[model samples]
Target: MNAELFLAPFLTGLGLAILLPLLGCYLRLRDEWLAALAYSHVAAAGALLALVGGLPPALGGIAAAGLAGAGKRLFARRLSGGASYALLLLGGWAVAVLLAANQPMAERLGHALFDGQLYFAGDAALWQVALGVPLALLLLRAMSRHLLLAHTYPDFFRIRGLRSWPTQTGFDLLAALVLALATMSLGVMGAFALVFVPTWLAFRRAARWRAGLLGALGIGVLAYVVAFGLALWLDQPFGPVLAGLLVLVGLLVA
Candidate 1:
């Protein structure tokens, strides 16, 4: 009965769930989906680093995120956005895989990246709560309006002549960061539902961005609650349970 263990991961996932879409919303406001692109790869690198390199590695991963963000901006102006993202994704994946293979406690690192066992409700990690919660809240506050705008109305933003690309870029960075943290806390597979499920529900039901976001948020929260319960009852992995709940929600709502 490790209470801290469960509490830690739950807090981490909750914080991440709130922060990621907020970041995406902000980036969309800036018309920079590419920013999100760079963040994804960078965050992946960061997660790998955190697992293997500890503090230094984690810092390096965060730094890589910034560098990648800048690179995406520069390349977007000069090259096709998809091409640039593809190159960066490949490069990032190569580096991350190499790091995972070489890092001194590689087994621990692998578990950190892939195992959902560490993040269940009853046995949460300390760092997940101590560090992740506050960071997520701060970022959410900083990017609030931009997120709402970006996710809700890109067309109106353009009509106003506001630069949505930069906003979107910022969102991408935040999304990656949150997703990275969540992955580290919950496992990579677990992160999938957080990104896709709510959005899917929104798409299936709502016509407006507001309605959609609301739908997603509601479904997201409900899915988490149900999935957590189901996992406990079945003695199964929480991530898959949560993901399944999302699928069910989509089916019922859609």
Candidate 2:
């Protein structure tokens, strides 16, 4: 058994649970529900490079995520939010499928990239999440107010002697980086759980914008504990097990 197994899982789970919901706060308000999923698909496509070319998939994820973020900013100018996100999501999935098809390790890569190999993730992944999570939190904290104004009131923000585009772009970059790091640790599918469930739950319950943030944080932590324990007891795949827990949480919240 890997000596760091317990630490690795805990850190990845905790780091993602905290950071992603914070990003989700902005994403939901900004109406970018599909943006995270699109970037994760890009990460999935990039991770497939690990099987075919033996490349560091994280680089692929970083590149793809950056590009998707850029695409959103650029395309949002002309297209509706739903349309632009639809294009990006379709394009990203196409890339993922193409990459998966080119690889011989299709099933293995599929499982590992799409669902995750979090249980088997080692020290490098743990360190990646450890560093990236705090950096993302700090970056978002610094930019959160600016982000709110820019996305929600672009003209007002710009009129206040602020160029909102630059700030929005900065958010896209930070969000992309966070998603890339998360995809590496949790797999693309699992990222959906970490990013959306807590935010949705928080927003649904809270009266004030920030009221349920802490509650969402608590829910995130509990979700991980429950899912992790259940997976262990059931001897099941951890990623799918967590995904199921998220869906159940979503239902219970509803």
Candidate 3:
């Protein structure tokens, strides 16, 4: 395999390997990690819809997940115990399947979305990650303190007569957009794995919040690089290879 062929894809995945785990730390802190899976699924559905409508799949995905993120507050009030996320996941899955079944072109893209097309990711994906990762980091850094307070001390804002909705809502939108971009490159379950596994291991092993963030980033990057190499050498799908490596790491850590 030519190294140049995969360089762009590698860099794109690497960016998400860093960014997703960082966001995962916050999602884990808030006990809202399920949002990753929900957003990815919805993004997949949106991409399929876009394919059918002759639009850019990434734009549709980001728009759909952004909407989902913005509406999270309303969903929280109407549904409890993460029910809203579950509904989104199932609904998205159903829509994606139906769209793919009805359109031959959509079927091919849908398979790519489900299994991951990282190796096929082009200049567009590279540019997306190039711009997105830094912006996301800046935003997260600015909101880090408020996020911590919002999650760890839910009543702190209330006591101070401050509304926490803005902070929470902003984070939700950020997560959705990031996950949508990731889903376009990494596939639904692959993006979710990055968000779930690294943070989970860090949560178990790290002694401090800062340490946990570092640990998750380290774990995600290491696994992603290794999986990328192994998949390229072994002629396997990147998504499953990455997920398997993470699970193996989890078992070893356990």
Best prediction by TM-score: 3
Using lDDT as the measure, the top candidate is 3
lDDT of 2: 0.75
lDDT of 1 by residue, 1-254 (tens): 66554665566566556544444433444444444444445566665666565564445555666566545656676666466666766676666667767875654555445545435433334454457657755765666666566567868867878776656566445555555555555555555566565765565667876666666666666667667667767878776777677778777777
Extract clashing residue pairs from model 3. none
Winner on TM-score (2 vs 3): 3
Q: Candidate 1: what lDDT?
A: 0.58
> Residue 104 in model 1: shift from native, Å?
5.4
Give lDDT tens digits, candidate 3, residues 1-254.
68899999999999999999999999888889999999999999999999899999999899999999988788687888888889989988999999999999899999999998789899999999999999999999888888888777878767977667657889989999999999999999889999999999999989998999999999999999999999999998899889989999999996
Provide the TM-score for each candidate, comma-separated. Answer: 0.70, 0.91, 0.97
Which regions of candidate 1 are displaced past 4 Å? 2-5, 21-41, 50-58, 78-81, 117-168
RMSD of each: 4.5, 2.1, 1.1
Cα lDDT of model 3 overall? 0.92
Give the RMSD in angstroms, all C-alphas superposed, for model 2: 2.1
How far residue 150's Cα lies from its native spot in candidate 1, in Å, is 7.6
Q: What C-alpha lDDT do the candidate models reach, one value each?
A: 0.58, 0.75, 0.92
